[model samples]
Target: MPHVPERRPESLGQAAYRQLQEAIETGALKPGDRVSVNALADQLAISRTPVREAIAWLETDGLIVHQPYLGRVIAELDHQMVNELYALRFVLEPAAVGMAAKNATDAEIDVLREMIAFERSVLDDPIERERHNRRFHNALYRTAHNRYVISTLSALQTPMILLGPATASDPKRLLDAYAEHTELVERIAAHDAEGARAVMMRHLTGGQRARVSYLLNQQRS
Candidate 1:
């Protein structure tokens, strides 16, 4: 039999970009970790060009900093950045949930219910519970039928992971969050746009409080 041609792997640059992005999102690349282009290329079995490109992309996204002679390092989270992120969420998520109430189909509501059930089942593991919580919120945003809202919310996911663990780690916080989600879903199901929006605002507010408290405690320590 004639030898078959092997399929080409993804471009080295694309692979490098994806791997680096995941590392940044999952906290594997912590703040201030130096970005060694040569070492990254060697480790990922790629070339210098791609690693450089990946670094450039991260720099543009403000996830990494480029310093003269010092090279690039993962960017640190600051108070202002955290405030701005939650502020943006406060403006956007309520609107998305309100719109979802008006436009979401019966099938979408069913999907939301399933998401809630999944979240409830994962309450013992904070990380897994948070992941499911994020999924539920993302699904609500998607159901809003607004492309920009969905895009903006999706971009916030990496920053969320960087906030250091879930507020749902506390049993009380987790239960309260679940109740808020349940109320929001009920409002959506009933086509109560204003009610859903109010619930969403409260949800985001509670989350912001938890995250801010965590950051403040970290500073104190």
Candidate 2:
């Protein structure tokens, strides 16, 4: 008989980490939801060790909290945390847009234009619109060509997802966001770093206000 290769062991820890992160981002595991290691292990068809490790990872990322008696729970967003997030975004995103304007290739700009077109087409579908919005931001970050900036912005996305409801929910706000995106793309294509930066900063500021307002309304109701 021919010898068979041994099966590679699965990295349950990594898999569990990804699963938990996705759940949190998609609102399935909402803020303050209890984390159950054994239930997660069963759900994921993995071991408790991995589930524990995954919880630790999320905790370190500020996505979840582990209490001595209360167990692990999804991290809830307070007004202060929201403000801090927007402040970080305000500082970093403009710098990223500026870098992108200076460094992005013609091919990259074309990709961004395509993303904008896709976003326009999906305006009626909130889910699809949100996906395109993310794509647009990811493309812009990629254009910056800075690994650190790209990674940091990528990490920031999970928290943004906690804001709930797509930013495209408001037609007027959606139109405004698209217009700003279009302007940013054009400036980048024109290699106007300062213009791109200014437009991006304004865009983020507007978006932050819209998101905060929406969250506040939800709390009120």
| TM per candidate | 0.82, 0.84
Q: Compared with the true structure, what per-residue lDDT tens digits does model 1 show for residues 149-204? A: 99999787656755544445567777889999999999999999999999998888
Off by over 4 Å in 2: 1-10, 67-69, 166-168
The lDDT, on a scale of 0 to 1, for candidate 1 is 0.82
What lDDT would each prediction earn against the true structure?
0.82, 0.84
Task: Note the residue pairs that clash in candidate 2.
Answer: none
Each prediction's number of clashing residue pairs: 0, 0
The pairs that clash in candidate 1 are none
What is the per-residue lDDT of model 2 for residues 58-170, given as tens digits with 9 covering 90 to 100? 88888888766878888877666888988888888999999999999999999999988888898887666776787789889999999999999978876766655544578
Candidate of highest TM-score: 2
